[model samples]
Target: MAGKRCLKGVDIMKLRFLGACREVGRSALLLDDNVMLDYGIKMGEPPEYPVNGVRPEVVLLSHCHIDHSGLLPNLMDIEPEVFMTPPTADLANLLLKDSLKIAESTGVNAPYDAGDLHTFMYKTKTVDYRIKFQTHGYNVEFYDAGHIPGAACTHVTSKSGESLLYTGDINTSDTRLVSGAVEFPNADYLAIESTYFSKEHIPRKETEETFIESLKSTLDIGGNVIIPAFAIGRTQELLMLLDAYGIRPYVDGMGKEAYEIMMKHPSYLRNPTHLKRAFDNAISVKSSRRDDVPLESSVIVTTSGMLNGGPSMYYLNKLYDDPKSKMMLTGYQVEGTNGRMAMDTGIIENNGVLQQLRLKLEQYDFSAHAGDKELKAIVKDFCDRGTKAVFTMHGDNTEGFATWIEEEIGVQAYAPVIGEKFDLH
Candidate 1:
């Protein structure tokens, strides 16, 4: 959809919700039909993509999570100018290539080929936080999102002085990896994720302690502890946490490469040395060593965080019948994913067969996104700063969050549906 011109000889700032309006995944937002923020794909059986047909002149990517940056290469035909932080660029490259490989191995049709990925990479420009840049008649700045390495909340303004602040994904509390997000930038409109709008996290320290206790108990019982983690942020955070607790786990899957990629961009890390030490202490699992991982009472960190695939599945297949063993899931499991299915039914479909798991299972809140209170604080901060409107999205209960913003924050709030467009004025 294209932006419409007003009769007053002014360009109207139109906002379109192409995806991630009321649910998580495939998060694409079009601003005046020229700028796109976060073109990502939702992971599932066939995988879901954002609504097609808009060729954004500029794409402001917020982070490197697959749900946020998965489909960037699909726009290679337009050769859209893409902007992101340095680490985000590198990590997105890693993930996009990995996504293609996974798709081919699973016989799923990939949306873009290697040629698209190469073209997309060539067009990507890495920008630092707080630096002002212009693209397609819009001024843009990046603010640290604290969600992961190189994750950013974007501030954008048009030549006409109309502006918007889009919180791609944010975390307000410090984690082992990144610091809390920077303060909000005042703008006319605010668009933010509400992933944990109705949920508050257990204090981070307490949650870590509980996780450690469970892990130790599982190991003391003469069983291996398998931790399924996301490759980018969660895996590194878990490694740091485990290092602090004097545990050297066997790390496997793409997380190994992600750790290496992150090391090249040390400025994004809270403590590069600490992460280095953690990685040095942990064992890297190679294909030849995969069979050796489950022989002892050790902690193994692997990926496909949702247990959809990766070495985590291999370990589960090996030890599923062992009641003493435990599989500790360490991230948000999207609905229809193997992790969610296993959590809810104790059965996960793997390799085209359904298998009941006898191993002890548990989920830990190691999310990179903000919690309930933090999310509200983000909304409130923008509202207090005179943001004219707030748009809640990227969660299941966004409508409730929007209602809260109207009732408590006294700002006009909207929960947009896919394909809905609004004149921001």
Candidate 2:
């Protein structure tokens, strides 16, 4: 894909890497005049770990994933102009509010509170995809990222006509939830995330088949299938696949609890499919409720994805000891998180209590992130016009992506360290 770019006498517009340059989590992309594509925090690490100054010129959110959207609260210091797509804005509010609650519940004194959440919401303005908007002399356009509902990859063009595309987190070929990253006709700089690059992709059918087989095996022995999924995108995607693949279990309260939280918004949902499912399956069960059905036929999908919070702990505590019960993780469990600890060794104590739970576990790539082959396809398209340079970040797999991008895509792609800056004119 070459011969599509038309950059003539374009000057101005700079790119900066604030965080997640080569790391998998904590994504922050700073632009000229402090407009950020995402102001986020790292997983497991303190969201505001360094206590450094990151006053973005302004902030634009791609989606509501905490890693991509968590740092908006700190903008209270910068007080930058914040723009989000309508649904992304809505979901971000829910996510950030809940995040504050989670932090406080865990007795971690968070910087921002409910008052800051309200103020942040008031500052957040919604922008539409494919439509151009102006901010501090930059023309920014949005495209459906397809990684999550309301997620978008942004195309920012300087007043001087220099353009850069920041793919917050992209999925080139997953359609279970969102479609896929949109192709751009013009882009000078492509800042892409390479979370799963260098790994051979498992065919979608194979992934689904693996999930079903695991479920069937657990069900056969009367065990519960506990899926530790992130509450936002991956959880919904897994639920849809389970329903599509004919493994509908009596969904528990986690989805319902999340939706009730969503209903506080002026609009219902960015995508209403799973919202309706959660509404339909709003069943409440006491902690001591007895299980009449065997564990094999039951399914439980809980959030925090990495066993960090929400109903995941409850499911693990309840079913961990049962031989028929199984835990299948469908997302990346950050290192040192509860999910990683469990996967590393099938043991996790129930919170502060010393009582432990154990279960046979199998993990799959149920979580959708752009992998190596997918990143190559996007870069191939972006650099078709002979892009000036390619910037790769937002991954733990740095060297692997660097090699593939140079060899396969044939572009000058590099993953910069945190706080790095580039002057492209």
In each prediction, how many residue pairs overlap at the backbone (N, C-alpha, C within less than 3 A)? 0, 15
- Tens-place lDDT per residue, model 1, 1-425, is 43332222234578888889899998999998989999998887767888899999999999999898898898889988999999999999999999899889878889899999999889999999999999989999999999999999999997678788999989988998989896777888899999999999999999999999999998898999999999999999999999999998999999989999999999998999999999999999996789876556889999989988888888888888889989999888888799989999999888888989999999999888899999998888887888888889899999999999999988889888888888765
**Clashing residue pairs for model 1:** none
Worst 10 residues of 1 by lDDT: 1-10
Highest-scoring model, lDDT: 1
Those runs of model 1 whose alpha carbons end farther than 4 Å from true positions after fitting are 1-11
On a 0 to 1 TM-score scale, where does candidate 2 land against the true structure? Answer: 0.88
TM-score of 1: 0.97
lDDT of each: 0.89, 0.71
Among these predictions, the greatest TM-score belongs to: 1
RMSD in Å for all candidates: 2.2, 4.8
